[model samples]
Target chain A: ELKVEQNPLFLSMQEGKNYTIYCNYSTTSDRLYWYRQDPGKSLESLFVLLSNGAVKQEGRLMASLDTKARLSTLHITAAVHDLSATYFCAVSPALYSGGGADGLTFGKGTHLIIQP
Target chain B: DAGVTQSPTHLIKTRGQQVTLRCSPISGHKSVSWYQQVLGQGPQFIFQYYEKEERGRGNFPDRFSARQFPNYSSELNVNALLLGDSALYLCAAGRPQETQYFGPGTRLLVL
Candidate 1:
């Protein structure tokens, strides 16, 4: 069973503060994804880290993956109220033949609230 | 390109009833996946279909079944629904080895 665990499940922070959400997985996999979901809305893809030490960043969010350690992290820089949303990290298990056709196992998301 | 799309954005059913949800994948995307999301939790994978064949399935029960069509559209059917079956059913579409784009989920409420 592949397990993805995320820390700081609930966060209430002020605007302009920086924070990092960590994601740890139990199994060995090369693909990790980060997503954000607003209340009662569909998930918005943030980053897809496909290899070890792969790092990708958007305007205010950065995500990195370390496959050997089976860990990934999403960092928020000077957050704003618009960034307040549930963040999730998902892992896809490696298959022998087909890759990523398998469904993803997701972590219990981190619910963030950024107050102005 | 248009993203993944789901039908009947909201549904209501009772226990022991049957329900079917629909999904249309993004243009040129041959793979479709389904997930169930309860309130206050992340989405859980249910099934993944590629080229109209079941490539993977999650740890769901036999009551949950899905099939993909020639056009890459898909349907998820639930039989003998229970109260626990009420959730937001999400459909994602993408190619192999890529980040799948999620659709606005169909919210199911069981009474």
Candidate 2:
């Protein structure tokens, strides 16, 4: 079974500060995804890292993947109050087909609180 | 294009009762997936359907079942519900090898 672990389950940061959330998976996977979810709302895709060393950035948030280490990271730069939400990292273990029917295994999520 | 849509935003049922949830995929999307999210936890995969056929299923009990229609719409049915079954049920749509887009989810409360 694939297992995903995330660090700093709860984070509190002041506006303008920077922080990083770490996600580590136990099995081999080809794709890693980042998503943000607010209370009572659906998940919003942040980034999709498809390869090792692949990195994607949107606004003040950036995500990177390292397949060899089975790890991924989400970095926040100059955090804002609006960025307060739960962020999740998911991994899909479709090494061969690249598009299998297997669903993603998700981390517990990092609850970020950006104080203004 | 509109994102994935689900019907009956919220539902309440008792133990041993059955509930059916509906989902409509995006216009050109042929794959539909279902997930369950409990409070303070990430979503867990339930089923995946492509071309109106079951392609994948998660580690759920036999009481949980799903089916897809020709139009790419889908329904999730749960029988003999337990209190643990109360959660937010989410539906997602996408094409093969593409990112899945999720719906707002239906909140089900089992008493």
CA lDDT, every prediction? 0.93, 0.91
The residue-level lDDT of candidate 1 at A59 comes to 99
The residue-by-residue lDDT of candidate 2 on B1-111, one tens digit each, is: 788999989999999999999999999999999999999999998999999989888889999999999899999999999999999999988876568788989999999
> How would you encode candidate 2's per-residue C-alpha lDDT over A1-116 as one tens digit per residue?
78999998999999999999999999888888899999899998888898899999999999999999999999999999999999999888775854478487789999999999
Judging by lDDT against the true structure, name the best candidate. Answer: 1
Per residue, candidate 1 scores C-alpha lDDT tens digits across B16-84 of 999999999999999999999999888999999999999899889999999999999999999999999
Per-structure clash totals for the candidates? 0, 0
| Residues A40-93 of candidate 1: C-alpha lDDT, one tens digit per residue | 899999999999999999999999998989999999999999999999999898
Question: For model 1, which pairs clash?
Answer: none
Ten-residue segment with the worst summed lDDT in candidate 1 chain B?
B92-101
**TM-score of chain A taken by itself, candidate 2:** 0.95
Model 1 alpha-carbon drift over 4 Å, by segment: A97-100
For each candidate, the DockQ is 0.80, 0.72
